[model samples]
Target chain A: QKEVEQDPGPLSVPEGAIVSLNCTYSNSAFQYFMWYRQYSRKGPELLMYTYSSGNKEDGRFTAQVDKSSKYISLFIRDSQPSDSATYLCATTTSGTYKYIFGTGTRLKVLA
Target chain B: SAVISQKPSRDICQRGTSLTIQCQVDSQVTMMFWYRQQPGQSLTLIATANQGSEATYESGFVIDKFPISRPNLTFSTLTVSNMSPEDSSIYLCSVALASSGNTIYFGEGSWLTVV
Candidate 1:
């Protein structure tokens, strides 16, 4: 089984809709969770980062981590066409140098 | 955030050839990583490049196929040796300002097409 499992979605949503992206992990050692947005032909940019269980909000983006259940999620509100991109869930141990990434969920916010 | 620049952002290489992708960072960092992103797959770490020493590779990845060079804290190179069609993928250079933070920053990536 893969360490990190994420829904491989080409999920389409109309503008202003709420979009939810999630990932699950089997490792209990993972202490930091991150969400990255990757545009076509471009490198991924960090959207949200959380170290422990709880919720963090930044504008239209919200990141939630459930360390007890080993799950994390990113919710995007008031989605726009500019939000179309691949969302990758990544996790890492506190002191480790490498991060384990999910397969990424492709999202398309239609105008 | 550190600014990373990768040369030959995209390239086409013939089989049995090699391509060296260069990564230059604007600031000094301790650890540099090379990753391969295949279509429809997550990023797989190729190796960890540390200056003044050999790179530490992940399982199933060997130095013979992917030789990495970390000549300094701000620069590194990953050369894909004996390229094949299966070797075609996006090669990314990454670094974390703090190892414990795990806050990684990636380069634009070198998209290589091996034919």
Candidate 2:
């Protein structure tokens, strides 16, 4: 099984719809969870980060971590065309330098 | 925030050749990392470049294949020693934030296409 598994979705949603992106990991040692947004032909930019099991909300984005289930999720409210991009979920161990990444889920919000 | 400048944003190289990608940061940082992103795949770490010491390579990657140089805190280079169609991918350099905030910033990335 892949260390980190995400839905490889070209999920299309209309503007003003709520969108959910998620990933699951098989490694139990992973303690840091992150969400990154990548535009076409560009490097990824960090969007949300979490240390452990909890929920964090900032503006229209919310990140949730369920360590017990080894799953994490990102919720986007009021989705817009600007939100169209690939979302990658990454995990890392405490104090470790490397990160495990998912294949990424592509999202397209149509106007 | 550190501003990163990567040279040769895109390149086309022949097989059996090598290309060196350069990454320069506006400010000095202690640790740098190199990553490879194949088409439709997530980023995979190649190695960690630490100044004054040998780079720590990730599993399945070796210095012989991807030699890295960290001559100073503000600059580093990763040379793809081999040219293969499979080696065609995006190469990126990144540095961790100073506050121990766990935030890593990446450069624009160098895209390599081998034939």
Candidate 3:
């Protein structure tokens, strides 16, 4: 099984709708969870980061982690067309430089 | 945040040829990583570059296929040797900032299409 797993979603959502992107990991040693946003032909950009199990809010985006279940999520409120991009989830162990990434979920917010 | 710049932003190379991608960071950092992202796939780490030492590559990656050079804290290069169509992917350079809790940041990426 892959260390990190995510749905390869081309999820289409309307503007102003709430969007939820999630991932599950098989490694319990993963202590840090991150969400990255990537546009077509561009590099991945760090969107949200969380350590351990907890919830972190950054503006319109919220990242939640559940270590018990090895699940992580990124919630976007009032989604916009500009938010259309591929969202990737990454996990890493503490003090490790390498990160395990999910295949990524493609999202498109329509007008 | 460290500003990473990669050379040859986009290139189309002939099969069996080699190409070297350069990465330069605005601030000096101890650790830099090279990653490859194929079409519709997630990023996979190729190797870790540390100044004054040989790069450490991950499984399935070898020094001969993807040799790395870290001559300084802020500059590094990755050469994709004897390329093939399977080598066509976006190569990204990333830096780990110790000051920022080891948060890794990536460059604009070099898009290579091996024909």
Candidate 4:
């Protein structure tokens, strides 16, 4: 099984709607969870990262991690067309640079 | 954030031919990483490049196929040998800054289309 797993979703949502993207991991050693946003033909950009299990908020995006369940989530509020892109969740240990990335969920926020 | 530059941002190459992708960082880093993102797929790490030593590749990746060179702290190169249609993908160079709590950052990837 892959260490990190996520739904490969082309989820379509209306503008200003709330969007939730999630991932699950099996590695208990993972202590850092991150969310990345990537546009077509572009590289993944780090949106937000949280240490261990907790919630971190930045602007309209919130990242939540439940270490007990080994699940992570990213919530987007007031979504816009400009927010249409692929969202990827990555996990890693605290001291390592090697990160395990999920398959990413494609989102299209319609105007 | 460290500024990263990749050369030959886009390329179309014939099968059996090899192409080298260059990654240049504005600042020196202790470790450099090479990742591959296949069409519609997530990023997969190819290898870890550290200066003064050979690269350590991940599973399913071999040094013979994806040779890497880290000659210095700020620059590295990955050469895709014997390219095939399946080898077409975006190659990205990344770094983690310890000063920034080990946040990983990526460069604008080099898009390759193997013909």
Candidate 5:
């Protein structure tokens, strides 16, 4: 199994809908979790960062990590068409630069 | 977050040719990484470029195929040698800033199309 697993969903939703993207990992050592958003032909951009098991909120975006279950999620409240992009989940242990990235979920928020 | 820039934003090269993508960071960073994203795929780490040392490549990636050069703290380059159609992908330069707690920032990416 891949160390990090995410559904590569071309999930479509209407604007203002709540969107949830999730990833699961088998490594217990992972302490740093991150969410990245990438548009067409562009590189991934950091959207949220969380350490260990907790929830972090940034405007309309929220990031949650569960170390016990080895699960991480990014919630987008009132998602917009501009939120149409690929969301990637990445994780790393403390003091490590190697980030294990998931397959990414492609979200399309329709107007 | 450090500002990262990559050159050759998009390119089309013939098969058997090579392309070198350059990465520049606004500030000095301890970790500069190279990543590749194929069409409709997620990012795959190519290698880690450490200043004043050779790059450490990931599994399935080799130095001969993707030679990396880190001349200084704020600059690095990755060359895709003997390119093929399979090599066509978006190459990105990423940096892990100190303040972001391992949050990596990526460049706009260098899109290459090998025909």
Candidate 6:
């Protein structure tokens, strides 16, 4: 099994709809969870990263990690067309610079 | 996030030719990394470029084919040697900042089209 797995979603949703993007990890050592947004032809920008577990809220975005289930999620509330992009989840273990990234889920929020 | 610049934003090269991609950061950093993203694939890490030392390459990646150079803290390069069509992809350079649990910062990327 891949260490980190995510559905490569070409998910389309109407604007103002809630969008949920998720990833599952098999490694128990992963402690840092991150969300990144990448637009076509552009580099990924870090959206948010949470240490440990639980939900972190920033504006209309929330990142939730359930270490027990090894699942993580990013929720976009009131999504806009500007929010259309690929969402990537990444994580790292103790004392390592190598972060395993999931195959990004492509999202399109249409107006 | 740290600011980064990559040269030759996009290029189309012929088979058997080599392309060297350059990365420069605004401030000094300790760790530099290279990643490749093929169409419809995740970002696969190629290597960690260490200043004044050899780069630590990942599995399926080799120094001969993906030679790396980290002459100083803020600069590094990756050369795709003797390229093939399969080598066409987006090449990105990243820096891991120690302060934020080594949060990675990436360059815009150099788009390579090997034909």
Cα RMSD, model 5: 1.1
**Error at A30, model 5, angstroms:** 1.2
Positional deviation of residue A106's Cα in model 4 after best superposition, in angstroms: 0.4
Model 1 lDDT tens row, A11-108: 99999999999999999999989999999998888888899899999999999999889999999999999999999999998778689999999999
Q: What Cα-based lDDT does every candidate model obtain?
A: 0.93, 0.92, 0.94, 0.93, 0.93, 0.94
lDDT tens readout by residue for model 2, B1-115? 6888898899999999999999999998877999999998989999999898899998999999999999999999999987889999999998886765776778989999999
lDDT of 1 by residue, B11-100 (tens): 999999999999999999998999999999999999999899999999999999999999999999999999999999999999988643
TM-scores, chain A, per candidate:
0.98, 0.98, 0.99, 0.98, 0.99, 0.98
DockQ of 4: 0.73
Q: After best superposition, candidate 6 residue A46: deviation in angstroms?
A: 0.7
lDDT of 3 by residue, A4-109 (tens): 8899989999999999999999999999888999998788889988999999999999999999999999999999999999999999999997999999999999
Clashes of each: 0, 0, 0, 0, 0, 0
Q: Per-prediction DockQ, in order?
A: 0.77, 0.71, 0.76, 0.73, 0.73, 0.75
lDDT of 4 at A111: 95
Interface C-alpha root-mean-square deviation of candidate 4: 1.1
* Per-residue error (Å), model 6, residue B32: 0.6
Q: Write the per-residue lDDT of candidate 5 for residues A1-111, one digit (tens) a residue.
A: 899999999999999999999999999999999999988878888999899999999999999998989999999999999999999999999988788999899999999
- For each candidate, report what fraction of the true interface contacts it reproduces: 0.55, 0.58, 0.63, 0.63, 0.68, 0.53
| Alpha carbon lDDT at B11, candidate 4 | 99
For the second chain of model 1, what is the TM-score against the true structure's chain B? 0.97
Model 5: CA > 4 A from native: none
Residue pairs whose backbone atoms clash in candidate 2? none
Give the CAPRI class of candidate 5. Answer: medium
| Reference contact recovery of candidate 6 | 0.53
Tens digits of per-residue lDDT, candidate 4, B1-113, equal 79999988999999999999999999989879999999767789999997989999999999999999999999999999999999999999999776778679999999999
